[model samples]
Target: MATHKRAETLMDSVCEDMEEKPEPYFSFGIIADIQYADIDNGYNFMKTRMRYYRNSLTLLKEAVQEWDSESTKPKFILQLGDIIDGFNVPQKTSDTSLAIILAEMEKLKIPFHHIWGNHEFYNFKRKYLMESKLNSKPLEDEIGQLTINEDTSETRSDQESFYGYHFSPYPGFRFLLIDCYDLSVIGRDTMSIKYGMSLKLLKEKNPNEDLNSPRGLEEEQFVQFNGGVSGAQLNWINSVLASSDEQDEKVVVIGHLPIHLDSTDAICLAWNYKEILSALQSHPCVIGYFAGHDHDGGYSVDASGIHHITFKGVIETPPENQAFGTMYMYEDKMVLKGRGLVLSKTLHYRNGRKEEPVH
Candidate 1:
């Protein structure tokens, strides 16, 4: 009886110590859906409220200034896509609009990682977007390329741009950025294999003549605006996770589309979220999933204790309001300090066996 009581007392003391303070390993800045345009303010399809398309540039500048002024300074900035608005000016002027936004990001003087969203596809082809805009070098150079499977000798050559990339700012920590539009209708030629596959899926899953409409679709995620992970991409992700697991490294996945159903609107989820989640479940290295698509934003922890955070869009913020955040990563938890319209959250880390999916 005495030994059991002492053990309980020791456990309680350890638990109390763990709750005392947070110790971050590293940190980074995160912003989503800047959607900057040179056009006047306009309303969305529903006309609920006006979208401050032009004002988003000011917001981006402010966010960069804030991030640059941080005492510890974030290692890098992660832009969650839609940097340039789809409705920006004439089609011929869209590229220039994109260049303006890119120039703003360059002022920070820190490495900026970008994920491609649907709206970006509205302006350029995947090859041009990836090779010329996003990537630091041409695709042929294939800098930092990873082998998907050692047994099959398959290399990830085509994905040099936005397909997927992993980075480690510190030992025992990794960030995986996924391109959710790999299999989407946007950015791919109609005659391409991926476009054909996307079309077939749309035909079988969505019966509406307007594929973008969610009216008759049983699954909210079947809409055309959303995209899925390709089989090759999935294999690459699994390989990376497996490698991370072997190294005992913790991972934070950043995608333009939400991977968890409850983390955002159903229509904003990735089409192959289930498959992606299943892949993530098999590897206990993933600690958090961050994304931006549904402007309202959401947060939820799965049964495995992995956090799913959908960042609010900067485009939706009215004048004087803002949306952006910085994530401080620690060994046992992550702290998100939100500014403007974004909400702060504390997510505890859990590294263990997989559990049932969170609704």
Candidate 2:
């Protein structure tokens, strides 16, 4: 029920000045954790939160209609993963559910990017995901295939089963779409190398037989529901950031798991988030990271001055409410045109870090 109340209040205050806000250089739609399923609504784990499984589809439709009505439509849209719920597979409605949602996004007729989350692995296997549209390998018209330093290719293959890629919409702005579950237990087959790695780590870190339970764990990240990036993926990201630095480009990091511990509950954090945060801090070209997975949502500005935003999940939003926004980027600030649970805000950044808030 509580959605990071303090941070939400602070962000709402920062976003209150949109009345005199200047024209943005670019605008992009933002939505996350749709987790859509055709089944009746139900409660979340621990039965502590209600989820509107059926109503989420309607919420997405509302968001699209709002985006279409905008005077200046977003150049693109970002769907921060969990487009469909894991329960869809058990009920045998996964394909239909996914298509119904994708159809709405297609109506916008603009490019959109997808980042992978744990739930995606719940429904689809690694091989299937590689061939799926969720791979961030959009067409040339939707998203151009940029050269991500180190000769990393976007070609679909069993070898590159994970969905980590970088693209530059404009010459000076780059988007790093990370595959947070690159090393996880659910997506790859139990016999796969990645799965073995995940199981080994989970066994070593979590003593509970129920790997998903975070009980009695000092660092709750060992839970099976969360995942992490492998060294190979990390190296690739380093290369991309290195290239960004050389080109004097500013990067906006996008992922499904909330990496900054302060910006998300410990249980919802990724496995190797400290390493991920360290990697991000090393790159002065990075401005912020956007994510989902934590239903209540969260916000924090790390020591390096990077913004970490965990958007509220559409499923957890009450049946009568919605969660989405359009981020308007300016020379010195990023403004939020939020609807429903998302708060509107004008966050200012200087040399890759945000201005310290005056208490």
Candidate 3:
């Protein structure tokens, strides 16, 4: 009996050691659509509940504090856009609201990347915003060492901001940040070439003279508010993905607009989502696509086995409630650990593999 008990104890010890082995290559913090402002709570255009514009500031602060306390801190934080809301009195209050949010993010003392969204453009022009908020800066620490392959050959019509960029954090992985609003009306002047193109495109598709209205558009995606990836940007994405594939690296594509119908409202999708999907399908190395804009959030696995994850909007959370997440990337899977309203999900690589849940 004593000999048998000793053997069982030894077996248990080995199993525990195996279970404790670390698998995640790295992790990062993700939050979306904080949409912070000093205005009073109000309903969305469709009467959907939008609560506590000021409270989002507190929510962001909590997220920053929580990330700061983690033992294995995130390599960086990705703010999925809309730092301020469209209703924030434009230039008068927009800059102040943005400053408040930026101050909170700065408390994290880590590299944080950003993208543009419709609401951002409502507050500032592309040139001003690029010069102020989206200016390219080196990330801090080892995370900053991840180099971006900038395509210098392609130039914007008016030296406008190019929000798309790629970074390789480690040997086997790359992150692609796409500017989904490349052809949107909000950021460009009436006389700008891109703005004219957007107007013409909307006029052709949407019969509603109020371009923002979807009443007369047959397809939900035909709304003027959503934008598409430009030809130049699409080429850049193709080049990046192709190069990454050659390096045997997997990619995670991040954007402010949803690229998949399963992961967002039909109306909130990018105008050229189908084309984007086709591009993604051709790239076997893309493991996941993360996005924000559909407030409620969702997840779906495409036929190509790429995971589409839409983060819950912080603005939609009720007063005192919170929404955010941290993503852990591993050899064969990625785990999104949710906080507050966000739902946790484990996305495996191709072949339908499974792994231990992220706690």
Q: Which model scores highest in TM-score?
A: 3
Global Cα lDDT for candidate 3: 0.80
* lDDT of each candidate versus the true structure: 0.81, 0.83, 0.80
State the lDDT of candidate 2 residue by residue for 1-359, as single tens digits: 36689888878877886545678888899999999999888999879998999899999999999999999999889999999999998898888888899998899888889988888888887777767777666632243334455534433446445677777765578888988887888766876677888889988899998999998998899898899988878888888887777677778899999999888999999899988888888888888899999989988878777788899999999877879999988777788888999988767664754333321
TM-score, per-candidate, Cα-based? 0.88, 0.88, 0.90
Tens digit per residue, CA lDDT, model 1, 1-359: 99999999999999999888656778899999988888888887557867888899999999999998988888888889888887864646687888888999898888788888888888777767756566532212132443346323223334222356778877788888887988888757776777888888877888998888888677878888889888867888889888888788888888899988878988899998989887887788999888998888998887777888999999889888889999998777889999988988887888556677555
> How big is the positional error of residue 73 in model 2, measured in Å on the Cα after superposition?
0.4
Q: Which regions of candidate 3 deviate over 4 angstroms?
A: 1-17, 136-153, 156-161, 351-359
Off by over 4 Å in 2: 1-21, 139-160, 352-359
Q: Score candidate 2 by lDDT.
A: 0.83
Candidate 3 collision pairs: none
| Candidate 1 wrong stretches, greater than 4 Å | 1-23, 89-91, 136-162, 356-359
**TM-score attained by model 1:** 0.88
lDDT of 2 at 187: 68
Candidate 1 yields a Cα-based lDDT of 0.81
Best by lDDT: 2
Instruction: Please give the range of 10 consecutive residues that has the lowest summed lDDT in model 2.
Output: 139-148
Residue-level lDDT tens digits of model 3 in 32-100: 999888977888767867667888898999999999998889988888888789878653898888888
